[model samples]
Target: MNTQDAAIPSLDSDLADGAITPIDRPTLHSVVVSRLRDMIIEGVLLPGTRINEGQLGQQLGVSRTPLREALKVLAMEGLVELVPGRGAMVCVLTAKDVRDMLEVLSSLEHLAGTLTCQNASDAQIGAVRTLHDEMLAFYRSGDRLQYFKKNQQIHSALIVLAGNASLAMVHDILQSKMRRIRYLGDQNDDTWSGAVADHEEMIAALEARDGPRLSAALVDHLTRTWDRVKDAI
Candidate 1:
């Protein structure tokens, strides 16, 4: 066998050892979008990086059609900007951009707090608690990526529980816009710990179903987010 072939682990051996498992693959567009998003968030493709479609398509083993489609989706989410001549560029946030979005997001979440405390079923609240537990588990295991995803999910779940489609939609856009900065900000151990403490307070207030208290906590969390992530931008 050639050296490349020799290095390949045998599928039969993996199957025999129960090390192989079947998994459903995501759609082409979804996979491309996810990979591109990760690359941007991890700084593999830094902010203001102009996307070279042809080269990127080759690297991703995809065609221009799917790549373009994925870029369109990302643009809508505010993670990438579509330029007239430049194709696509990763979105760059100034400190001012971060501040503006976080301010708006804080107000939205503050509103969501009252609505959620009033409208959410016990089951809905419990679902967020479950996500919090899972997030904490990921944090304990030092799985930062999974923890970050779960953390976002918990916030989104609260917005969802508010039972307002508009709030959820806007929150999603803002969350996507800030994803990379938030991930980078938490790189500090002290900042990450403070964030966890903030979440603990949030969940506690939520479980108590105290509208004012929950709103206070949500506002505090979102407002303090600026401090946690300001240096990252």
Candidate 2:
């Protein structure tokens, strides 16, 4: 063989026989969509990157049918853009989108906390307290992921305590949009400490059942969080 030809290695000889195993194919469209969504949120798929169906399907060990369905769901969530001839691309979030989402979420969360102060059940308050304790534990352990889950529980519990279906639905959707950003913020050392303190303060207000105080605190907390991320987002 020529020197150039000898320099190239063949794939079949790169490893022991059967060194690699194929991944399991996804059975449901939602599962496929969720896997892709996770990759996008976790930074595996960066913003504005084109998704090649054939290549992505091969990478994911999925067929075009399932990959297409997954792309459709991502498009609905504003995470993927559908181009007429180019297929899907990861969405690039703009400042405007961030601002609008912050406004909506802040208002709804503030209102939800206010209503919770007035109408929350004893059991609901207890549940929130439990979640608060869990968050404290997670924080102490430096497990930001667990802390994040507890944070969601606390927020969702407050919304449920509000007893407004429409408001809860709105808050839930807003939460979905901002979760990844919030998670990253919580992982930062300085941000995490301050965030823990804010949670404690909010819990105290909830325990006191003070609607106005809770409402104001909720608004301020959410606003500050968004402010921290404003420049980057």
Candidate 3:
């Protein structure tokens, strides 16, 4: 192997039974849990896909101990379902589950937006606007991945602006559940332009400090987005 090639683990070597280097982070449990969670959300591990503990634990380079604990966390998050003696698999959302989750998410976001409108300082609004502008430029550049990353920033900023710690915590949890479904929905739905427009309107409402208007806009935006993807579920 060349110097560079020798520096990196060979694909075959890394896939070996004992190839996983031990993680040194103190919070290894959460890291393992988060990696598995992202794989599930990104559809790398499809919904209803049976999780092979041995394969997964090996692939992730951890002992089965941490992998099992990670699966347990996912089960609590509703991303994975535990089957007695059968092990865990990604949770499949029925149409009803999708509908219920969408409704709950929309309502909660509406509440958050309303509270943000009431409580956000001018500086917070300015920050969101800056992020929105950056998003617009990134979208114009046709960089969906970059835009998606910034899209996350904008949402998190809004939640922080809400000035409610509990609501922010709730949003983080809900966003994890919605991530996979939202990706599928966004992929099939052609209403991204409308969605962006709605976001602009949301900004306007916030700028105006109109609590009621922001709340209504959030609900309408989430509902419309959900409707577009509901049929696919």
98-166 per-residue lDDT for model 1 (tens digits):
999988899899999999999999998999999999999998888877888899999999998999999
For model 1, what is the alpha-carbon lDDT of residue 123?
Answer: 90
Error of 2 at 75 (Å): 3.3
Clashes of each: 0, 0, 1
Candidate number achieving the greatest lDDT relative to the actual structure: 1
Q: Tens digit of lDDT per residue, candidate 2, span 170-208?
A: 887777666656665674788888888888889999999
State the weakest 10-residue window (summed lDDT) of model 3: 183-192
Q: Give stretches of model 1 more than 4 Å off.
A: 1-25
Q: Could you give candidate 3's per-residue lDDT for residues 65-109 as a string of tens digits?
A: 999998988887778999998999898988777788778878778
Candidate 3 lDDT (Cα, 0 to 1): 0.80
Pairs with steric clashes in candidate 1: none
Task: State in Å the error of residue 165, model 1.
Answer: 2.0
TM-score of each prediction:
0.86, 0.74, 0.73
C-alpha lDDT values of all predictions: 0.90, 0.82, 0.80
